[model samples]
Target chain A: MPHPPVHSPTILCTVDVVLLTLTADGLQVALLVRDRAPHAGALALPGGFVRPTEDSGTRDAAARMLREKTGLHSPYLEQLATFSGPDRDPRGWSVSVVYYALVPPMAPDDGAPAAVEWHPVDRLPPLPFDHAEIVRQALARVRSKSQYSSLPVHLCGERFTLPQLKLVYEAVLGERVNQVSFRRRMDELGMLEPMVGETVGGAHRPAQVWRVKEAFRGELSLSERVLAGRD
Target chain B: MPHPPVHSPTILCTVDVVLLTLTADGLQVALLVRDRAPHAGALALPGGFVRPTEDSGTRDAAARMLREKTGLHSPYLEQLATFSGPDRDPRGWSVSVVYYALVPPMAPDDGAPAAVEWHPVDRLPPLPFDHAEIVRQALARVRSKSQYSSLPVHLCGERFTLPQLKLVYEAVLGERVNQVSFRRRMDELGMLEPMVGETVGGAHRPAQVWRVKEAFRGELSLSERVLAGRD
Candidate 1:
């Protein structure tokens, strides 16, 4: 008879989110302070175990986790990367599916359950586990995504001025974009339309506000012009 | 005296690669056969344990495993996602970080050490674990990335005809693209330049070949014009 073969060990799985929102201060992200061990009292991304019922599919699990933790329904979410090192967590060898989500800046509802708070991205506190590194990677992905797609709009309110949208893009990309060029590009992409009877007041001028067109909701694609000079 | 709490079992960590290449048969990907218990002898993505190394990162471990399993050297690799579930594997709880890589096609070296083979993307056999899902997600990402950036060039030879380049793009995207539109888009991105002395024999006429410009390396930004549809 052949001898029995040895088998590899099992691993624990979890999902974490880097939820971004544009704020007056700058680009902000939601983080939670762990109230348990392994990284007790340390800042971390909002996450939890993947329930068995939620494991019907890959995207399903991620979506479920996102909604449960953030209270945002079907937000713009993309898989960032996974963090699975032996020492990433002191408990054991665990793997985390990290996702990045873009949401409009708004105060949480009175019934929002998670013990989390939004921190301006530029001033993030040290995070638990390998979360600080995860946040960095997520921001990089957001910056890259903003260049080709209309994802920055997801971080702004429903009705906004072109300058407000431009500021969101600049905040995420960490660069000063030419105002004229930015508006021209947005108009070309059909990302915005003049809001009916809407104006935003500033110091000297009342800027016309615009809302994202419905047709452009799921039509985001990478821009070839931006790719040309990226390298 | 305070009593310590009972801890959960230890989790195992692993890394898997969605190794892709461009071949005469269109896009091809490498798959391995698991020879041990727990999906034994089943087709699977090439992967291995994450060794306890002080210097190597998660991606570094993935690259090392990919190089060891496949004879190809990949210059383009990105972290796809992590798979973790209590019962994903019958053996125990296990988490796997999946990485996607694009490699140029070539015959396997005689000294290559793994029992790996490349299968056309359209005719892939059933894979072990959750590898089939990993491949699907990786392909989707590759297609989306190709639309904005010149990433598909990494899957082609250093110098390739426009027809060959177009075919590669279509295969990854799973769609038929208008040749005139595709050519115009490529030209506007400035990703490729006409080669001085390269021609490929075709039935009717000799097709001119183009080489990817060196200045585009490591520049993965998308074009504003492409998004705006100005070109």
Candidate 2:
């Protein structure tokens, strides 16, 4: 066995959030310009060091970072994976516990004050410190979960017609969905409740508006059958 | 924001492995009696603090601990979740990057001399730290993955008959599986290859034995259709 160093280096701990939202163009990630050293002025994911004195745990730190950096509270937040190594960070050996957050499309007048830049995921510019890989993994996870879950609904606002929700699913899935099957699958999920006296005018007819059930706002409804890509 | 501590305590980093194997009784977890404080003499999962000098990353640390303590090399190991907090450990703030390893049942003389005790997961004794919660999460993850993937096959020897593999799946799932559907599901997975001239005698007939394809030893084959519990 090797003896420990008289003064071993402490590991640097931090949390990074991959905040994703769907737009007219496609899936986009929220990023901010780094305001500190090591990568100052470079665009990067919203992240910060883990403040043990203030954070109850890593999850709390993740939520706090999301709130502080992006100024947007995600309707869905989940721990994706932890990335660590000696060579990943220049300051020292580091471990980053990453979390992915899903929020509905934000209106221009939303109260968030952060200067967040939304970039298409597939056409992202070069990122620093393994953040590009982190975004890729988060995208893969969201897409995979969308195949058999109510995950994509998190990208839709509270009141949406079935066609509107279907578009959100198609945007995340990157494929067309059969209208009939999509309706049937949504019925099976039972995660949405039709809002009484709320209807949206469609090209052919008025469509009933729906909102995710209060019980499932923070949770997901899963299905055994996967949504197949376009035939 | 609060001011930083004059000398803030560093987070104690570690890795804990939940080593699981199926037995005649059902799923069992491997545990070791801690030989040092703060929980000396208490049984807990095989774990240790991360050694940045020798370990490339947290995953490397987990593999090292499993090798040094258990003496059994697992073919299937995956990151389960990270457990972290200030109050979870007695010394100070800590973060445990947890990994779960799946290995086939061992023989009496498997060359492992760690005095390892296998306890049924459902009937585990009191454990130290947040280990009880860690074990629960590991079990839940394994069971969830087993429902739609060839994950339970990790609990079988290299060469096993179909009936034998089915038994392993049943033990992990805690329910009886339909014979016809099980065979069909295995065919869909296509992860097995029949060994030439390898036959095991059974009560009714000679059963042909099969081994997992080399390509799938480190990965799993998944299906969209879930394995339903006992009807």
Each model's DockQ? Answer: 0.28, 0.34
Candidate 2 lDDT over A65-135, as tens digits, reads: 88887777655999998999988877767899999999988876786555789899999989999999999
Off by over 4 Å in 1: A1-7, A10-12, A51-74, A108-115, A179-181, A191-224, A227-231, B1-14, B36-42, B48-61, B71-76, B83-95, B108-110, B126-133, B144-231
Comparing to the true complex, what docking class would candidate 2 get?
Answer: acceptable
Per-prediction TM-score, chain B alone: 0.82, 0.92
Estimate, for each residue in A17-39, the C-alpha lDDT of model 1 and write its tens digit: 88888877888888777777767
Question: Candidate 2, which segments miss by more than 4 Å at Cα?
Answer: A1-9, A202-204, B1-9, B202-204, B229-231
Q: Distance (Å) between predicted and true CA of A112, model 1?
A: 4.3
lDDT of 2 by residue, B91-156 (tens): 677889999999988886886665788999999999999999999999989987898899998899
Clashing pairs in 2: none
| Docking quality class, candidate 1 | acceptable
True contacts kept of 1: 0.40
